[model samples]
Target: MVFAPGEKPGSESEEAKLQIASKQIVQNAILRAVQQVSRESRQREAGAGDTPRGSFRPGAGELTKKHEKK
Candidate 1:
C-alpha cells in the first residue's frame, strides 16, 4: 500500500491506495499517541525520585569488581 506524492484521497488513481494509506496513517497516529503517554508517565514517576519500573539489577561483572575492591 502506498500513497503517491501530492495525491489526495478520492482521486481516481488513488482510490485503493488511498484507503490503505488512510488506515495506515490512522494506526500510526494511535501508536504514536500511546507511546507519548507512556513516556510521560515514566517521566512523572522519575520526577518524584522513584524508579519507574522498580529496582535495577547490577551486572555480575560490576558487582564482582566492587566486591573484590572491598
Candidate 2:
C-alpha cells in the first residue's frame, strides 16, 4: 500500500488492494503483540522462585479421579 501526496489517486481495484494490505498489516501486528505477551508470561513463570502448587495445566484435558463415580 503506497500512499503518496503527489501521486494520482488510486483506481477502485488499487484502493481495494490497499485496504486488504492494510488489514493484513494490522492483523500481523496484533498477532506479534499477542505472541510477545505470551512469551513474556512464560519467561516470568520460569524465573519465579516459587513452584506452582496445582497439577492443572491450562488448555489440557480434565483429569478424572479414580474415586469419582461416572
**In TM-score terms, which candidate is top?**
2
Where does candidate 2 have its weakest 10-residue lDDT segment? 3-12
Q: Tens-digit lDDT track for model 2 on 1-70?
A: 8756655556456668899999999999999999999999998888663646665557556566864568
Error of 2 at 51 (Å): 9.0
Residue 55's lDDT within candidate 2 is 55
lDDT of 1 at 35: 100
Please report how far candidate 1 places residue 15 from its true position, in Å. 1.6
> Candidate 1, residues 1-70: lDDT per residue as tens digits?
5657887655757577799999999999999999999999999878767544455646623646557755
TM-score of predicted model 2? 0.52
For all the candidates, what are their Cα RMSDs to the real structure?
A: 9.6, 8.1
